[model samples]
Target chain A: MRLLTALGQDIRFQFRHGFYYAYLVLTILYILSLRLLPESLVYPALIIILFTDICALGFFFIGAIVLLERGQNLTQSLFVTPLRLHEYLLAKILSFLLLSIVSAFLIMLGGSVGGQDLLWFIFGAIFSALIYTLFGLVFAARARHVNDYFVKSLGIGLLISLPILAYLGLFDTPLFYIFPTRATLILLDTLGGDYALSEKLYSVANLLIWFTILSAWVYQRFDRYVRHPV
Target chain B: MIRVTKLHFAYGSNSKDTLNGLNFHIDSGEVFGFLGPSGAGKSTTQKILIGILNNYRGTVFVNGLDLQKLTSDFYESIGVAFETPNLYTKFTALENLDFFAQFYAGETRNPNELLEAVGLKDAANTRVSDFSKGMKVRLNFCRSLLNNPKLIFLDEPTAGLDPVNLRKMETLILAEKARGNTICITTHDMHVADTLCDRVAFIVDGEVSLIDSPRQLKLQHGERFVDVEYRDGDSLKTKSIPMDKLGSNDTFQDILKNHYMETIHSREASLEDVFVKTTGRSLQ
Candidate 1:
């Protein structure tokens, strides 16, 4: 009950501060850009826009929220409550996940993309956002300023985007799967065509593994950050 | 409600200890002041008690539970008003309190009632960003009371308040005490410590030098003498005599019997004076 209340207030805060409206504007622009693109370019644009704007942007959103909360000493107040670290992290992840899901929906709708692919798009967007949001929590954990936070966020986003080259058929190395981005892109790719059951399972299992590791690391780093934050 | 023994804490591996081998305890319904100058570890100790800073080498027990062992539910029983106001700037004063009130499993006081008690009833609908420093402090002080905590921690509770708000805060604190709540306040302001604390500890450089009631400390460090002023012709004359035998002292009796007395006062030290004398440093 307390967790739900906290999440509700956080959502209300984000809405009242125009963060949700900003998300709305960004999502509409991405969808409209896809509509303007040539028919042949729409497929590749879908790949880039879905991964970069919908998935990776969630990282920046979480980073921005963390920095703002730190400035207001909101984390210090929340730390003293009955709210556990995981519960807090879950609340943040869920809030951003909702935005990511909406962004995915709008992109797919605008492109006339549907069928089982929509389910895959929604699922892939959620897990992708979760992975990057955890990464964002680590990046912004010790940040002292908004500029510093974005600088680190940009750096981490670049590192995570390495697998995008392989996803685009520019890099042929199988080792690219080590990064969760490759698995996420493959999941989205499979959703658009008929693929072997084993391949889909491989992508799902790989992303889940990465999610577990990232969640554990995020929990530890976030605990340290709130206990003795910069 | 709080017991700390050999409480030693340092910020980092290479940093010096902020609180070194400190020990103190407060009984139920007691108002104890942790008095110290800036950077003297008063806030650090309060943070440790409130579970903000952990990983210290010490034994702390608050409300009969070990500090290290206590979980988040422990916070449900205590309230904290930080030295700097920490309310959400975008939210109205009442909204901030109502939002925070939802976190507690226990019943909480009405946000408007708490604001009214602090004389900020009119600012209930105002955003915290628009409030003055005094107004923010008043709101912060009352937010801590929304939970109706048994133990409260206040850091510089009246730091930036005007005299009127300051008195209102003091009265509210006294009211809390009257209701049998334990308060542990951290402040360097002697007047605040003198007025609200039943007992105070003078801390300097992460160590305590003295701990006693304000009246007892004042009397212990005060001079046992009285100064007598009288009118002599067109001039005013003053004399100091030992207070032990003032009634029998010939000079004092002669002056009182023959001359018109102007003023007579015993030299009692203020809390600030005693703090400086005991610590060899002023409370800045």
Candidate 2:
């Protein structure tokens, strides 16, 4: 009940500032521009932006929430209950993931084009958003301040995505199969069947494996790392 | 009922224990007080009991369950209010109560009724971040009772309030006792300890030096002399007579019978004096 109230407060805070709305409007404008480009590029660009936008927003918002809660001493009050660390982490993830998906879909709605298959887009978005939410929790657990989160989030995201980026940019190889985010991107692009059965299974399996590990790591480290000095 | 035996606890990698070989118990239906200074282990012990701190040595059993084991429904039966006023400052007083009120499985109580109990109904809608220290203290006090818990742990429960509010808090705590809850109060205010506690343990340097009722301890250590005052003709005089001889002494009886006796009473030691004597440290 308390977690729900806090999440409600977080939602209200999102609307209280003009900058929050501006950020959404700008993203919606970017999505509209993609619709005007070549038809061949629209699906791929939307797929990339879909996964990228959700992951970026997930990390950004979750990081800010964790750092701000610590600053406000809300973290201290939470532990006074029987609220296990895992429950607290789950509540935070769910609240942020719901907002991310809602806001992302809202932005995408302002534009006409989305993807080849709505089901594939929704699946890829939800799955990738969850993983990123867990990843952001792991990120925010260590970041003490918002600016530190900004610097460190870019560094960490780059560090994790580098293996695939380097393969794509420097070597020009098909090593997009290595990073989980790119795997999700490929899955989104292959929606409505332009790919083989085995390829689809492998793509989903790859994402599931990485998602499982990241989720476990989030649960294990979140409470164990951050706690009142009881 | 609560029982602790050979309880030893230490901070991370510290050479000495915060609490070293401490032992105590409280029977059912009694208000237990733990009095200690800032660095003493009062809060540490309460944390261990409330299942906040693990890695403890020895055993603690609260209401017959092992302290280390975390259970789903135990929260419904217990409540804790920390000394630091750990409240969500961004939420209003009503919202703060509403949030924490969800963890318990018991019947929910109205936040307005609870605020009224703590003298905070008018400020229910005001943001806690805007509240004064005393207002937060009242909110913290009210938060501890939201679940209508059977066992409540309060650290400095009456901190940062005016005298009238302090008295109201005292009455509120005793009222909880009337409802058959076992309360553990931790504070250095001997007056609070003396007034509210049925049995108080004077803890110092991580160990309980003495535990007893305030009246009993005062009787045990008080001076056995009564100050007797009387009016002799136009002059008033006072004298201290040994209480043991008051029954047989001729002059003591004559003063009480013949002259206008003003006042006569025995001196009783206060809880503060007992704390100072037993621990050799001032409660202040």
TM per model? 0.95, 0.87
Candidate 1 ranges with C-alpha deviation above 4 Å: B245-262
Candidate 2 chain B has its poorest 10 consecutive residues by lDDT at: B67-76
Off by over 4 Å in 2: A1-49, A71-73, A80-84, A147-153, A163-178, A191-197, A227-230, B227-239, B245-265
Task: Please list all clashing residue pairs in model 2, or write none if there are none.
Answer: A2-B99
TM-score of chain B of 1: 0.96
Q: What does candidate 2 score on TM?
A: 0.87
In candidate 1, how many Å is residue B120 off? 1.2
Q: Tens digits of per-residue lDDT for model 1 on B1-284?
A: 78899999888664888888898888899899999889999998888999888888889999889888868898887988988888889899999998888888899988888988888899899999999999998888877887899999999999999999899999999999999999999998899999999999988999988989999999999999899999998999999999998899999999988999999999889999998888899888
Top-scoring candidate (TM-score): 1
Instruction: Give fnat for candidates 1, 2 and onward, in order.
Output: 0.60, 0.40
What is the C-alpha lDDT profile of model 1 across A1-230, one tens digit per residue?
87787778778877888878987888788788888989888887887887887877668777778888887888887777667777788888888787777777887788776666556555677788889888888877788887888897788789878888877778767787677887788777765656677866777888899899989888888878775552
Model 2, A27-130: lDDT tens digits are 76767777677977665566556656654567767888777677665675666665666677767666656766776676567555555566655666677777
